[model samples]
Target: MASRRRSLATYAVATLVLPLALAACGQGGDEVDVDVTGTAPATPAGSSPASPSAGGSSGPGAPPSGRTELPTSKRPTVVGTVVTGLEAPWGLDFLPDGDAIVTERDTTRVLRVTADGEVTELGTIDAAAPEGEAGLLGVAVSPGFADDGLVYLYVSTAEDNRVVRAELRGDRLGATEDVLTGIPNGFIHDGGRMVFGPDGHLYVSTGETGEPERAQDREDLGGKILRITTDGDPAPGNPFDSPVWSWGHRNVQGLAFDGEGRLWASEFGDSTWDELNLIEAGANYGWPEVEGRDEGTIEGGPSGDYVDPQAQWRTDEASPSGLAYADGHLYLAALRGERLWRVPVGPDGAGEPEEFLVGDHGRMRTVAFAPDGRLWLTTSNRDGRGTPAEGDDRILVLKP
Candidate 1:
């Protein structure tokens, strides 16, 4: 039972209730204000191929009611193959044995889903993970897994949500140690995504516990990506004096490093905007201050600085979730969009985010590249959405 910081009082609660969402709305005019949080006005989808900046409405939303039959477009259909049977998997990672571990959000368990489609129940964490948006979320393997036997996980517990490290034995997880704790613990804003950066340090994406204002708070871990060492201390040379690597995000769900070792993050925006941002050290992404580039103007006021998203969606195309960089492209999993986006990358961030496998599958949650050079993706169908097939929860492999 750990206590939150004194600063996380009101703003943290704001992120939990729906009202705080209004703060994410980017302010109009120039020079965005730091404290003003407002809702982003509803806008149509923008910038498709040809002229990406061009705007349009979101494609068909989730099925009208039960078992909504999705339309199939004649676009490039990415054939999906079942690589393994899994639970409601949130994050996927690979082990040295070529086996992969998948975290089940609601069931409070982890599975070693092998490439052969066999699932080995790897015990369960009976602590706590409230439904709505919380549960056992992102996971990352240690760089020294071969020697350390350590596995890191971001979980939402009844007491609080934070990052924990443990050892992986045969079928059970060994002693669990808390690396980082006391992040706001709402059903949302747990900011449950984690990844090992190129520098071998852990880079974590934490939601503002629904408190949009905390996204802009330098002293808080909410709505920010934190860089920490294996022992849970802030990595040396961090942009701020704290564990924060980047801040001012609504809910950062996805994290991936490009071929050049540049980090990219995908976020779940408010009703209007969902985003894909290139994460940089000591950068502030507009959250309560600004939503996207349109509202991040300098004239709006707060000169605290802001980072623009590489690409954004009309809220429909991108309940942007887990992301993985592979095949010279950045693959992002869309939870609300029910699609996978392939964002081409250059020296900067993204060039064009092409919608692949549109409506071909259900909601995509996590995407990871296997050592075999194939893409492994997880679906979120079981989480309060469309009907799950006989094998409701599953892990699929995609190969070009």
Candidate 2:
């Protein structure tokens, strides 16, 4: 457990135990003040992106309900280019044979890319409604992919954000079926990221759809980390008896399990700070009520129990999106920061975070560990927020 330095002491448990009074609220206006530890490494000359003005949410989050001993780790470096010429590529996963299944956000196109750099269009999800930041987002290959041939997706529709699954046939996807539905939706803050945990349950991340109040509403699906079975039922032992595994998240976009099966998420913070949290079952991550660290600051003051992030950064330094754990470190892909952040994790919790590939790859969106132990990193230069370089959207393979 890394030390948490806050301006205020921890709140009493009695106040936090009361039923939350849900009310629509605007974004917090107070300046966020929290003790920031460690320093970001400098980027290469002439490679840095313009410093971003504040306004975003979440970077990464914590692990699931489980814990285990840490394993040996390794550092990763770019090894090769897997493919290029993509359009706002977001979700990425690999097939049993090592073929990559990718999703393009705006195009709603699902693609299969071979290791040799051969790209093939698998199909498109017509139901996906691509807007400011929502569309066909995260993709997860079934844990039983070799046998079930199923792939799951988190998609934004005109009505709501939902999870759907389809069979992966040769070179194409079969008819899609609803796995879960009725999540809130918005033009921005549509948290969409999915990964299967070692417990064989599906973990889904959702945003508050810009409704700060919704994040605190236990009945709402938005702004929550959900644990469900492949069929979308609430996973056994869930604290809320619903899909929610954790709550009060602004917008969680990245999730990865470490060697110990503990889950970590990268989140986007609003204006003040971006966060990397170790998720735990039923934990509450303060949203409108608090931003980065709950210094007992904020206008109304911190009234509820909220989990402090294991690590945090300025929004300009880490509007982090994708996250992956490899070689005993958590790799975070920063969008506004234009860098990859490596945070060392050990028995005492997260260590000092270091920056890498700063501005080297403009606006990284996703980073995932491959079957062969290499990492697949995707650039989000074409995501409408970033200035695209030549090959705007592409994938880079890295060795750890």
| Top candidate by TM-score | 2
Clashes of 1: 24
Off by over 4 Å in 2: 1-75, 296-303
lDDT of 2 by residue, 1-400 (tens): 1222331122221011101111111111112222212122122223222221212222433221222222223334565677767878899988989888999888889998877777788889999998878889999999999899999999989999999999988988998999999989988888888999888989998988888898888889999888899999999888889998888788888888876666778788887667777776776777767666654433442334677776777777678888888778888888887777777775445666766666778888888888877778888877777776655577877654
C-alpha RMSD by candidate, in order: 12.7, 10.5
Off by more than 4 A, model 1: 1-80, 83-85, 295-303
Alpha-carbon TM-score of each model against the true structure? 0.80, 0.81
For model 1 the local lDDT of residue 59 reads 20
Candidate 1's residue-wise lDDT over 1-400, tens digit each? 1111111112211111010121122101111112211122112222121111112122223121222222333222333444433445787889988888788777767777666566677777776554667888888989899999889988888877889988998878886789999877776656677888778988888888778788878888888888899999999877787898877778888888776667778887777667677665666676765554443145453335565566667676667788888757877777667677766676544565566656556777889888877777777667655445555455666652
Give the lDDT of residue 88 in candidate 2: 80
